[model samples]
Target: MELSLLFEISMLLTSACAVLLAGWLLWQGQRQRAMPALAGFAAMMALWCAGHIAIVQQWPVLGIALVLANPLMPMFFLHFAVQFVADGSKPLPAWLQRGKLLPVLYGVTGSIILLSWLGGGGKVISSSGFSAFFVFQGIGWLNLLYTVLLGIAAHLILWQGWRIHSGNKRRSIVAMFLAGGWGLLLATSFVFPSLGLNWYPYPMLLLPSYLLLLVYGVVRYQVLAINAFANKALLWLGMLLLVLALMALVSALLGQLGMQALSAVPASQLWLYSALLLLLSAACYQPLSQLARRLIYPGGQLDESLLAHWRAELQQAQSWQELALRAGNLLSARLRREVSVQLPAAGDTATGLHILCRRDSSGWQYQLTGWDDVTPGYRLQGEVFAALLLSSCRILEQSLKLADAERKRLDQQHLVELGALSAAMAHELRNPLNIIAMAAATTPAETRGHIQQQLKRADRLIADLLSYSGQLQLQCSRLPLKPLLQTILSQQDWQGVQCQLKVPDGLTLYADSYRVQQVLINLTDNALAFCRNQAQAQICIETQHDNGDILLYVHNNGPAIMPQQHNSLFQPFVSKRAGGSGLGLAIVRRIMQAHGGDVCHRTDLGWPVSFELKFKQQPSALSTQIQDNIND
Candidate 1:
């Protein structure tokens, strides 16, 4: 066959690929704003390649379509480049923003070219020297100039984006930049044939190389987020195409070599040769596909050793939380994307490229998100990941069961210890405290008061120990917030202190009133102690709504808690303040937990120190009782 015929075949194949890519991009464009421009670019590329095919077949109308599409192609590319790198925090440069008019101008130019062609003012002449190509004459040269300039401007915009961005965005920009640059540089050769240079458009032979670069960008950098299912289908299609092409080439070579026996074979025996070729293709498919994938995505394959290591690590996990964290981290590191392993909760169905995992009986769900790219081989890797996760989740369930059993055993042991400790405190310590109180009655007024204070402190210490050890049974009720805060403040010796209550008069909380009072007393007492020495000692009780929950804050203008102590601040027997029982915050935490709430020390509220109590907003029958009382 002639080389010209081969180039024509190549152009047809390139056009087919370009059209397919354009459709794929358009489908992707429905979900992503950046894809329409890219889709348009691919459509123009298809038209341009089709024009070459048309010119070879001596079809003049479709041949002219190529020239009209030429300038418009790069304009689409330029628009895509601008949209691709657009970040809300960064505005487009003034000059580039003004350059938006270029597309409109090019669109008008394309229209003019089409109108002129229809009016017979312009013509496409097939090159007599190169049978596979064509040249433009008259106003057609204007379109070529427009194409060259637009191509350069598109590349410049991509270059700017590549320079301005970093990380994955930068890498994506680099992919587009390099691909467009190669396409522009090689594509420029097509203009030479029309320049009266007898040079064949050899660059057209490498036209598919530009598409390959774009594919690399799409696969490697995730320039476009193709679906995994689509990726799998494409991979299969590609392999099938490869097999067919190889078979055709082999048949053509056999014909060229003039194999007498093979050529002289009867038509009835052709099925045997076809069957042999089919068998050969089948035998070669797996290895060839694997080899191609290995070359394309080197890190995608899961090694046996790595799988074994992951299994061992998952099985050995001490707790369910640690197991989830380890699994998520391992997947994130392997996939180079974010992965989250969590207990499935109410609200959203798993979001953003997530897989619902129902691997184990316990039904723990994990999501793999942040899928910026889907390469050819990732479907196989994704299957492997799912299998690994399924097996790992069973291990996670076992670990959680074991942890629960251990906790039950420890709780029984703790109850036994509490019983013995309580006995010791009542027998050994309470007798002496009672004696001190009795002796205080015989002492002078000032001396008696000092002795009474010491007795009360010792009694309170014993009570706190018992409270911390024993499980609480709550009697929840609707308590008015402002009045509750007022009663607690009245008990405080904050005569000269600036005590502010920011609680709404009608605000109410559904909790055990006694426990709520105890929590407030502990928090307020701590705040008062901390800020007592400050020049303008102040304490503020504030409430804010948070996602149906109420946040109560007790903040003070006191010396900040040391950063080093923040970690263990809520632990029992841990205190920085002198003369503290070291059980106040720990007791407060216990009470909050019993109410299905939580308390934490915070420093972000413009106060030196603050303790926030989050009251979970659970609906209750008594919720409207306080409001009724206020109305009355």
Candidate 2:
């Protein structure tokens, strides 16, 4: 083909590719706001390419019409850049926004240029006594000046956007600048021919290089929000082209060798030679394809051995943090990018490239910094790696949950065994203790009193153990708060202490009356033990209804519990007061839990120390069955 014809064909193909890519992006919902403008730019370039071919073919009217229509190309490009960066939210400066008027001025100028060219009054006259280059002298100069002005304005806008953006966004803007800069250079090439240098190549012929750079930006950097790696249709097309190129190459090499050998063969034998060549090409197709895939897509598939090794590593990971670290290292090594993992902690400051998996209260963050040159094959690999990482995280979370559940189950079993032993020991000691009390009663009144007090303490301890063992049953009933509090306060020994009830008369609780009394008594005793030394020792009993639950707060004028002891304060045998059985709070918590309620220490209430008991307004069937079993 002739050189100009070859250039024209290249320009047409490039323009078609550009148009198809932009249109496909628009259709696929990739950067919808910016894609239409990019499509317009591509379509205008296609028109320009067509116009150049027309000009080459001596079609003046069509060429002039297309060239005049070409002024809107840069406007569309500028529109795309602005939309891409601002994302239709950031307001452009007034001067930059005024660029929308350039197309209107260019249209009027194009009309004048066309008129001047038709009137034959704008031909450039060479001083070398030779006529050269057909262009509208006055109008073409004016058009060139406006094109330069538009190009400069577009670059300035792009530069401002680039400077304002950061990180990934900044990278995308840089790609835009590179693509647009090359486009500007091509646009400037038009000035050469208008300056009486008609020997210069047509600016449209440079479309292929410009389109390639734009495609790189779109596909690799996702400059237009077009993730070409994720586009299966585009990937298939690329693979098809690669296969075809490989076949052509293999056939050409084989054909040359066959032709050399068949140079002495007769014309009748040419058909046999052609048949042999076809057979050989078919035979080599699979092997060549495999070779091409290996060379071109090294990272497309994960090795089975590598995957198995990773699985082993994941199994050995002790915690989520350890698993995250291993996963980050694996991905970093595979992708050749800096990778970091962030685990959830107090005031955690780690960040990631993206979040891979998040479930329940756990998540995984992966970093892919410095992987800007990532190919479709590598991207596919990264996706597979991400899947692996997510699966590993899921497995780790499940393991932790199962382990925690098993530990709780075992701890409960141990507590049950301990409680049964304590119950047996208390039963055995009760008879002997009663006999000893009887013997002490005969010896002296003082001895009898001391023995009775020690016997009572042992009995209370036994009762607490039974409650802890889940043997204590609840007879749940809807009971009013006011009368229950009055009766309990009248019965309790309140020496040198004042008790205040803040409960509303209408408020009621759904719990066993006896068990609720026991809970209040224990709380009051614990409070009085701490506040007895105070000049105004006081206990405040308050109740509130919240979100279908009843909250009862027992406040005491006592020191607050230290933060470190908060977690273990409710466990059996853990007491802060000297010569006191630690089972009071523990039994309180156990009773509340069994009743389908909960008890927690709170410092935000009526006094320095308070314990809140939360009871469900309406008990579920399960809680009723549990309460019945406990009573049995």
Specify the highest-TM-score model's number.
2
**Each model's TM-score?**
0.46, 0.47
Q: Which pairs clash in the backbone of model 1?
A: none
Model 1 lDDT per residue over 1-632, tens place: 45577677668767777788888777755655767777787787888888777777878677767655676677777777777766434556887677557567667756856754664433555453455466666667776776677777777776777777778777777777678778777777777766877776777788976875674564354434554545754675576556666556565566679886665554324533554576677678779988987988766876789889778876776654566567667766777766555533312334444444553555654444434466745645655766777677677667677777888678557755875787687679998888878878998999998888878888888888877766665777777989999988998998577998999889999888888998999989888888887889999999999998999999999899999999999888898778788989988987887677899999998998999999987856334332111001
Query: In angstroms, how far off is 19's CA in candidate 1?
Result: 56
lDDT of each: 0.72, 0.68
lDDT of 1 at 124: 51
lDDT of candidate 2 over 1-632, digit per residue (tens): 24555555766677677677667656764545776777777787778667655665667567666665555676677667776666644566676576666467557545654554555433333212113223545555555555566566666777787777666656767887788778777766554555656554556466677865775574455444445443743555465556556555555566567765535443324433554565576568769987887788776766789888877886778787777777778767876765565444312324444334454544554444434567767766766676677677767778988898888778677777877798798789888988887788776778778888888987877777776665656777778988988988888777788888998877878788888888888888888888888878888998887898889999988778899999998988999987678888888887787677889998786578989999877756435434332212
* Model 1 C-alpha lDDT versus the unseen true structure: 0.72
Note each model's CA RMSD in angstroms: 22.3, 22.0
**TM-score: model 1 vs. ground truth:** 0.46
